[model samples]
Structures are given as structure tokens and as C-alpha cells.
Target: MQNIENKVAYITGGSKGIGFGIAKILVENGLKVAISGRNLDDLQEAQAVLGEDNLLVFQSDVINFEDEVNSVKRVIERFGKLDVVIANAGVGKFAPVDEISLDDWNAMIATNLTGVFHTLKASVEELKKSKGYYISIASLAGTNFFAGGAGYNASKFGVVGFTQAAMLDLRKHDIKCTTIMPGSVTSNFADHVPSDSDAWKIQPSDLGEMVIHLLQMNANVLPSKIEVRPSKTS
Candidate 1:
């Protein structure tokens, strides 16, 4: 297992949900973590909980490539180097293909698909320097289509495809890329409040542990694509 102590990681959408979970775990395991989100209040709140010693918070929107570039620069400035990048920022909108509004579809595609590209593009050079790891939080919807999930499905499917191709491209440089496709995570995705009713779903912390496991793997081993679901369905 590779030692992750003192390595630096930048997680998009790290203010809450899966990103926050990953940031928390990475910090506990002795990593310097930078978390970015568009919401300053939420970012500050997360910094308070995660503490100032190992955490840096930035207000960034993934839809803008410039924002991502600046974020990577800031991470490097604060932590010196970035060894991990998690493209976990995403938004979901569910509607029938015919009924989905242009605004909603564009929002999903821009934030979920294009956003991943921007994040990776902005950080690839630093990752090459560190021979690091990049992980994107995709979704089971990428592979499974549902009645009202046209927009969401398209975006996640793009994420899965993009990350897989990126994995192939980055491996020769000794950089590892993986897309984690999760099902029914208990998060505030799509404005749904997490509650006891979500007990059967996968938890954000569960995914966090998965990230740590991947980071600890031998350099020669790479689980390029992973599909994770809850053991029991609600």
C-alpha cells in the first residue's frame, strides 16, 4: 500500500455530501485537502468542521474553466503540490426527454459533464508532476436509464465515458484515473433531504473509504471503473 500521509488533494463540491466525506477522511488519514464550491457559507461551515490545519476552502463554480484553473493554482500555492483530484461536483435534473427544459438539460450537461473535463484539464499537469490519482463521482444512472432521468442520465453517462478514456490516456504518465458509479447515495442531490428513509442507500462516508482504499493501492494496480450500490434496495 502506498503511504498517503502529507499528500494534498483537491475535491470539487467538497462543502457537503460525498465531497465533504472524502475530504474529511483524507484529512484524518494525514492529507492536506482543498475543497471548492460556489457557496461561501457552506464552504466556511465545512472548513470549521474539517479545521484549518489541513483544509482550505475556495468558492468556485465548475462550469467555468477559468474558475477551475484558478482553483488548481490556489491549491498548489497553499499545499505546494496536489496529489489527488476528485471531480465530484455535479447537479441533477430529472425529466422525460420530451418534457425536459433546455435550461435544465443544459445545466445538467454543463455542470456534470463539462465540469469534469474542466477539473481534470486544469489539474492534469500537476497530477503528472506528482504521478497522482484522479477520481470522478459518476452515477449508476450512467448505465441505467429511467423514465424521468433523461437529462441526468446523459450527463452521468458522459462522465463515465470521459473518465474512462482519460484513464487510458493518463496511465502511461503514471497517473491513475477512475470513475466511481454510485447508486442511491444518501445526499442532498436533486433537492432531496436525507433522512431515516434513506437508511438503505449508500452513505457518502462509504464512498470516502473507497477513495482511501484506491489511494492506498499499489501503483501497478488500477480499478479503472467501479460501480457501487447499496447491498439492499429500499
Candidate 2:
């Protein structure tokens, strides 16, 4: 297992859900965490819950390339280095292929696919410098197709593909890249709010633990792509 103590991590969409869960765990494990979102209020709320120690908040929108780049710089300036990045911010727009509006499709592409790309492009240099890790939070939809999932599926599929290729490109530099594709996660993603009814679904903290496991794994091994799901479904 690699020593993650004192390493710095940047997590997009860390205000809530899986990203927040990951940040919570990383902080507990002695890594400095910087979480970014577009809303200052949400970031502040997260700060209250996650505590102030080893935490930095950046109000960044990953869809904007410059925003992502500046965020990288800001975090580096505050923490002096960046060792891990989790591209966990994503949006979903579900509709039949024919009924999917252009705006919805574009929004999914921008926030889910292009945003990951921008996050990576902005942070890759720092990762290379630190010989760090890059993790993209994709979805099982990247490989599965269903009615009314056109836009979401396309964006997630793109993320999985992009992250895999990035793993190949980055391994030579000793920067690990991975994509985590989850199924039926209980979170406030899209129209779903997690509740007792979603107990059968994977929990946010479970996903966070997965990232922790990856970080603790031997550096010679990489679970480049991982698919996680609920143990049982009703």
C-alpha cells in the first residue's frame, strides 16, 4: 500500500454525494482535501459537516476550462501540491432518444463528459508532478443501454472510454488513472433523493471506501475500471 498521509486531493462536486463521501474519508485518512462546486452556500454547508481541518473549498464549475484551470492553480497555491483528483461532478438528463431536447443533451455532454475532460486537462500537470492518481466517477450506463437514457448513457460512456485511454497515456508517468462505474447508487443525483426505499442501492460512503482501497493498494496494481452495484435489488 502506498503512503497516502499528507497527500493532497481535489474532488469535483465534493459538496455532496459520492464526492463528499470520498473527501470525508480521505480527510480521515490524513490527506488534505479540496472540494469544488459552483455554489458557495453548498460548499460552506459541506465545510460545516466535514469540519475545517485539512479541507479547502473552491467554487469552480468544471464545464468552464478556465474555471477548472484556475481552480487547480488555487488549490496548488493553498496546499502546495495536488496528489489525487476525482472527477465526480456529473449531471443526468433522461428522455427517449427522440424526445431528448438539444439543451438536455448538451447539458449532459457539457457537465458529465466535457467537464471530466476539462478537470483532467487542468490538473494533469500537477498529477504528473506528484505521480498521483486520477479517478473518474462514471456509471454503469456507460456500458448498459435502456429506454429514456440516451443523453446520460452517452456522457457516461464517453467518460469510461476517456478515462481508460487516459490510464494508458498516464501510466508511463506513474500517475494512476481509473474509472469507477457504479450502478443504482443512493444519492441526490438527478431526481432521486436517497431514502429508506433506496436502501438496496449502493451507498455513497461505500463508493468512498472504494477510493480509499484504491489508494491503499499496491502501486504495481491498478483496478483501471471498476463496476460496483447493490448486493441485492428488490
Candidate 3:
């Protein structure tokens, strides 16, 4: 396993759900992390849960390019170096194609697609210096489309294509890129209430473990893309 001790990770939407889980694992392995989110209260609560001194919280909306740039700068300024970036902030809303409002579609594109671009744009230079890894949290919808998910599918599909192109662009510098597409994760994404309906879904921690495994892979090889789904889905 590659040693991540003393490494610094910048994670968007790290206040809860998948981002928070990944942050916990990285911190446990001796990495210093800066977790960013739109809500300061939630970010602070997450920082408290992760404990003080190891995790730093930054409140910024990933959709804003300037904010993204400043947040990356802040992370490097505070931590001295940045090794990994996880673009995990996203939103999902279900609606029929004809019923989907333009605002909803735009929101999905802004947060899920453009947000990743802004994040990478903000951190690519630092990543190039450290030959770091960039992980984009896409979804199975990127490949497998379904009803009432038109906007989300479009954003995720764009993410899949974007990450692959970025991998090719970054590989020459020894920088790695990975797009993780998970299916039916049990979380409060886009206002979905957690219930027994989510019993068979994958947990946030499972994705965190996947991240650890990917980061631990030999530097000589890059997996590039990983598709994760529940073993028992109806």
C-alpha cells in the first residue's frame, strides 16, 4: 500500500454522506484533510465529528469558479501541499423529461458537471506538482440511464467523459484520475428520505473503502475508472 501518511486531501461536500466517510478513512490513515461544503454549520459539525486539529473545514460552493480556486488555494496554504482531490459534491432530482424544469436541469449541470470542472481547474496545478490523484464521484447513471433521471444522467454521463479525458491529459505528468460510479447509495441525496427502501443499497463507508483501495494501488498503474453497485438489487 502506498503510504498516505502526512498527505493532504481536499474533498468537496465533505460535511456528510460519502465525502465525510472518505475523509474519516483518510484521517485515520494519518492524512490531513480539508473538507469543503456550502453550509458552514454542517461543515463545522463534520469537523467536530472528525475531531479538531486533523480536519479543516471550508465553506464554499463548488459551482463558483472563483470560490473553487480560492478554496484550493486555502487548502494548500493551510496544509502546505495537496495530494488528492475528491469532487464529490452533487445534487439529484427526479422528474419526467417533460416535467423537468429548466432550473432543475441547470442546477444538476452546475453542481454535478461544472462543479467537477471548477474543482479540477482549481487544483490541477498543485496536483501536477505533487503528481496527485483526482477522484470524481459520478454514478451508474453515467452509463445506465433510467426513467425520471434525465438531468442526473446527463450530468453523470458528462462526468464520465470528462474524467476519462482528464486521465489521458494528466497521466504523462504522473497524475492519476479515477471516476467512481456507484449505484443506489444509501444516503440523503437530493432530499431522499432514508428508509427500509435503502436497506440493500451500498453504504457511504463502502465507497470510502473503495477510495482507500484505489489510493493504495501501485503508483505505476492507474485503474482509471471503477463501477460499484449493490450485489443484491432488485
Clashes of each: 0, 0, 0
TM-score of each: 0.99, 0.98, 0.96
Against the true structure, what is every candidate's RMSD?
0.7, 0.9, 1.2
Question: Which is the leading candidate under TM-score?
Answer: 1
lDDT for 66 in candidate 3 is: 97
Q: Write the per-residue lDDT of candidate 2 for residues 1-234, one digit (tens) a residue.
A: 788899999999999988888888888889999999988998999999888879999799998999999989988998999999999999888889999999999999999999999999999999999999999999999999889999999999999999999999999999999999999888888867778998888888899889989998998999999999899985
- Candidate 3 segments whose C-alpha is farther than 4 A from its true place: 195-197
Per residue, candidate 1 scores C-alpha lDDT tens digits across 51-92 of 999888999999999999999999999989999999999998
RMSD of 3: 1.2
Candidate 1 residue spans exceeding 4 A from truth: none
| lDDT tens per residue, model 3, 1-234 | 798788899999999888988899888878899999998888988988898787889898988999999998898789999999999999998899999999999999999999999999999999999999999999999999999999999999999999999999999988999999998898878877778878899988888888888888899878888999899985
